[model samples]
Target: MLDWDDLRIFLAVARAESLSRAGRALKLDAATVGRRIARLEEEMSAKLFVKSPQGYALSEAGDRLLPHAEAAEQAFAGAQEELSGAAGQLTGQLRIGAPDGCANYLLPQVCARISDANPGLEVQIVALPRVFNLSKREADMAITVSRPTAGRLTVQKLTDYHLHLAAHREYLANSAPLTCKADLRGHRMIGYIPDMIFDKELDYFAETEAQVVGLASNSASVQTRMVQSGAGVGIVHDFAIPFAPGVVRVLADEVSLKRAFWLIRHADDRRSERLTRFAEALGQGLRDEVTRLERLAADTTLAGL
Candidate 1:
């Protein structure tokens, strides 16, 4: 008989694209993951993955098994949560996929509170630079900068947040004055790599005339760190600015940008009232947090730092 644990391992390997990454996620060593995958393949008497220099790619057999495996995973998760409920406790895992910016700067506080409230619940944060596919069950919920146009998902505006052109105090003092948008050309700029920009909302340089980015990364947290290190001026979220010493908003009057976060979840999961309540609480907490962030952003004392 096939083992469910092996299927879980297969899912991890498929999602991660590499044995090393799958091992990290599963808390197993690479050799162990490899052995389990080999064992699974032997049991099925078929090739499940195409091992390549690039990484493991799912074979035809693996592709055929994926959806069913995902369904079984979902069913198992639902059963565990429901069974726990019979014992008067809610027990399940909630994976939230978010961009590095939000995941690093904001979700920590929110997730902490959720974990405190539900001691039996396990929370997994999938902080990735790319878009999350809700249809694939990549996340139980997702927080996206823009509302997705199409998906069988429940979407709501979490909150409207702000971003500003910012740089370290030392970088601004030494660089050419950014009295206007035109002055931006004289200084180095850091932002997301143009070709790797996964969403249109993250293209901070779209309206700017920056000839080239001095530093670029797919992760917004990396871009923020580079800017904080006095590398260059970059657009940063208001929530993140106060936490980084010596970082402050620049050209605030001229370059503030408004964006909203959309909360998304698979529509079918709405049947669980616990998740719906948790989502509601999380959304409200996010709104309150953004309000605090906006106040801090507008404060000149902190901005001077």
Candidate 2:
């Protein structure tokens, strides 16, 4: 009925038979021990100890629970050992969640390496959307561009990414080039729904006619493919633009915006090797890969935007 911590405190009190002695043994104060024991007793609905002039003595309920207490102690100890082995050996599934773009372009190789390294460990990469649950354990680790604020969640800034309005090179052949951010208003735009919103920054292109709700699907990959196919000028990240025959950069007049990417894990769940190794390996590898790709994207801009 009680938590492991409460059970540990209760066992200490029952073994010592003195609140003060149990508190001393557990490195907690007598009041703390009393409260924990009270909570346990309330949960089990059994008076565990009776107060005497000397100190605490086991009640009938407490006396009867001694064997079960010892068994629980041994069982918990065994569980701890098994968890340690699981973490160290990583003989389980590693679930990594991220947005579609990162999950598609980056995580595949990283997951392959993780699976190859830990043959016993299986890796499932889930591309969670803008609003997903990490606290509910939807996935073990996340590759995100937005900052998250969840209890027991730990985040690390993995890398920086830049977005630009781009289009097919052929599409831009006869049209006027977008010299400034506002020039995008005149272009036939292929837009993408905002994935990781830069809500805090005054990103120039966030909510203009450039990103007019009048346009296409919400998929980033769709935005990329459409732009590549000369469907319309779209806002695509530098890293996702494929070096196809036709793509070109549209509005190069002003710097759009660069966002910080994050690799996050639940602090409580980091004890597992599946999460630990995957986060570390995937984060560092993706950062390195993105850095290299960003440099390449700078060299060959997207077609139109």
Candidate 3:
């Protein structure tokens, strides 16, 4: 005899990791969310979450209940969409997890277009420095650089994009000559901290002998910015060049990297037609963006020549 409203609240709180955040999402006050959690725990006769300074962490019972709640939510959404007589009528929030680069440069435009078409849908982008955990329900869908090896998830290759060693024109003009890869050692370089790299696929410097980074950050966007500011040279995505106006590819003949993005979602949610369409839209958007990136890279290369 548990209330569906309570389960909805519980799911929101678990996802947001804070009562205040869940309340804002649900359009309820924080006090109301707290009262509902208290009621839910009383009805279930078990504590659901651990209240802490870092926000709410799900207890063992809450973790066990999460999948059931998500399943129920999906069922309700399917029924609602079917009853409305439009498979395109999606009315729930989809949280997408992705690396900082894609989250900042790609998904905002993509999600905006999707949300415009589906007026009832909300898209939340969770930009993380590391890989997203689909099994933990960290996101409804994720865009990953590396293909997951183990998980009950549906994954698709979105698109392949290129990265190149780049530096600001001003930096190149003002600093040492870089006629060869060996010259990289003498220049101030911006890159990710070696110890903080979360995935092997992101280890762009692995093969290089460069041992020093003048400035380090976990975010590709930040590194791009530093390079744009003429702080140092760094590797940047071809697509991201549009943002860094003065940044230009250097050592193009010697340094070109290719990487791909994979879209992933829970296996059980594959039957959700709305989710499927959204994922497809994401793939198409990325493909279009990759095409643009290729053209840009070609143009830049020609200009440099």
Candidate 4:
């Protein structure tokens, strides 16, 4: 019989696309991952990957086997969750994936409410730049700026908010008046590193024609910190810096950037009270934060937060 663990290794290698990377992700050594793959291939009489300088690419048979393997994996997991759920006391780990800065401020409050509601629930929160796959159950829940793509998931729009250029007090006083986008030429801009999709909604200064990016990072927290430290002016969402201690929103009335936040959860577990509780708690937090964020944007007094 082909081992289930062997199939799991094959799935991981295929998903990650590199033996070494899959090894690190699976917490297995390179030799072990290679050995498992070799053993599986020998048993099945096939080659699974074509290796090259660019890394491993799946062979034809490997490609065909992927969906089946993933489907089986999902079936097994759903069965487990459903069976455990039927027994009634809420149990099992619930993974929440969210971006750093917002998750740092928001998820804890929601989680505390969930944990209170279900004592047996174990919460694991991973702060990532985005959600990867809802179909595969990469995380049980996600807080994201994007709508969930999986049809089987329940998606709730949490809030609508906008982003504006923010600068240190020194930059506003010493720098050119940010009355219009054209005023941005030559001004150093702190921004998300190129390749961040979230930056697409925040191209506030790109049309200014004089745009200059002084520094970049993929993290919202990093961008907020740099802007607060006087490194450069950066585009930040109202929620992104609702409590920024030293920065001020620049040209809030002029920037045309706004977006909605969403909470995504798989529907297979939708009827579970804990899932519903967690989602409701999170939605309430987001609703409350949206009001606070708008008030922050309106409060021109000191960026005191």
The top-ranked prediction according to lDDT is 3
Give one digit per residue, the lDDT tens place, for model 3 in 1-305. 87778999999899888999999989999999999999999999999999999999999999999888888888887777678754556667789999999998888888887788888788899999987776556888899999988878898999999888888888888887887777889888888988999878888975454668889999999999999999988888888887788888887778788999999899989887878988988899889977876677655541231
Candidate 3 matches the true fold with a TM-score of: 0.84
Tens-digit lDDT string for candidate 4 (1-109)? 7676888898778766788888986899989999999999999899988888887778998877776676566565556656875454455677888877567766777
Any idea what lDDT model 2 has? 0.68
Cα displacement (Å) at residue 208, model 2: 6.9
Query: Order of candidates by TM-score, top first?
Result: 3, 1, 4, 2
Model 2's C-alpha root-mean-square deviation from the true structure amounts to 12.7
State residue 263's C-alpha deviation in candidate 3, in Å: 1.7
Scanning candidate 3 in windows of ten residues, the lowest lDDT window is: 296-305
Task: Estimate the TM-score for candidate 2.
Answer: 0.64
Residue 28 in candidate 2, Cα distance off native in Å: 43
TM-score of each: 0.75, 0.64, 0.84, 0.67
Worst 10 residues of 4 by lDDT: 296-305
Candidate 1 on 1-305: residue-level lDDT in tens?
Answer: 77889999998888777999999989999999999999999999988999999999899999987776766676776678777754544467788898898899888888887778778977888999888977556888899989988977888899999998888888888887777778889889999888998889998887676677988999889988998899998988999887788888877777778999998987766666657766887898788888887688666322332
Cα RMSDs, all models: 4.7, 12.7, 3.1, 5.2
Q: Cα deviation of 173 in candidate 1 (Å)?
A: 1.7
